[model samples]
Target chain A: DAGITQSPRHKVTETGTPVTLRCHQTENHRYMYWYRQDPGHGLRLIHYSYGVKDTDKGEVSDGYSVSRSKTEDFLLTLESATSSQTSVYFCAISELNTEAFFGQGTRLTVV
Target chain B: QQQVKQSPQSLIVQKGGIPIINCAYENTAFDYFPWYQQFPGKGPALLIAIRPDVSEKKEGRFTISFNKSAKQFSLHIMDSQPGDSATYFCAATHAGKSTFGDGTTLTVKP
Candidate 1:
């Protein structure tokens, strides 16, 4: 219920294509993150940005990339889409140790 | 290496029954444990959280029981209603970052 919104609630892309998902937050939280939610796997962190230009890799950051050039926008890009990379993507924002606020989630599929 | 492991892939309970979900972690460095609930087509929402220092935390019908020595924590829903049925995830934090376990799908039948 926070001010977080994800663009293109659903997307279907072919394999070996380029795709980018956007996450926008109005909360202006200091930390931003991207994660993929899959059945029996929960939510896995892909990439996160601690500041405008400071980003870090997560445990599942193999074929994903991220950029945070502004305070409210973070983008997750799939350089070359794969079948295994298809899942529900979520963007979350958190400040300090408070609960992280999440977007509605973007469901992506690769065919 | 998965730092957190959650059990009971799915669960079913009658209305007003209690539902319990367990989570265990391999790393003792994790200081923060939180539970989140998610509904279909929606994102995960914070339900409750607990620190290692406290053995238990309660908020409304949701309670978090933590055992530091055992390196485990759990969520218990008292008087769980059909509306409380959803996917529950347990997570742990490592230096400002968090990792989630495979969620438990709870279906409370009315």
Candidate 2:
């Protein structure tokens, strides 16, 4: 909520086109994460960055990629947008042991 | 295998009643457990959390029951109100990596 914001809060894109969702934070936390939310599936992690240039894949990493060139910003990109990739995406920031602060989320639609 | 398990995809409760959501984890390595509350068109927010050393933690009308031996935990909402209606998720983490439960949709009727 605080210090966390996601851009393109709502978006509609055509299939096969690339799209990027931006996560910006002022907290300067060490960890940033990207998660996708869907009906009946709750939230699924796509990727997370432990620090600038340090990233790892999550349970649902397929078709999604992330880059955290700066500590305060993390971006989730769809290599090639597909209808299956349409969902609400969340961005989170956190330190080693503290709670994660999540962004409001970006609702994406691909047709 | 799904590491975190939650039950009752959805629940409906009346005001003043208690809504209990259960979660079980397969990884004994998980040391930090937390529950999150999310409203419509919003990001999930942290509600209450518990460490493995403690058996229970209470804050306001929310309580987290931790059974370290059983590797199971639950969230109990006392004096449930209509405003408490939201999607609740249970999560556990180790080394800053987290796994989340499927989530429970609780609708507290007035």
Best by lDDT: 1
Alpha-carbon error at B53 in model 2, in Å?
0.7
True contacts kept of 1: 0.65
Q: Which stretches of candidate 2 lie over 4 Å from their true place?
A: none
Error of 2 at B48 (Å): 0.4
Local accuracy of candidate 2 as per-residue lDDT tens digits, A14-91: 999999999999987999999999998878889999999999999999999999999998999999999999899999
Clashing pairs in 2: none
Tell me chain A's TM-score in each of the predictions. 0.98, 0.97
Quote the positional error of residue B72 for candidate 2 in Å.
Answer: 0.4
Q: Write the per-residue lDDT of candidate 2 for residues B53-92, one digit (tens) a residue.
A: 9999999999999998889999999999999999999999
lDDT of 1 by residue, B1-101 (tens): 88899988899999999999999999988888989999999999999999899999999999999999999999999999999989999999866788899
lDDT, candidate 2, equals 0.92
lDDT (C-alpha) at residue A1 in model 1: 95
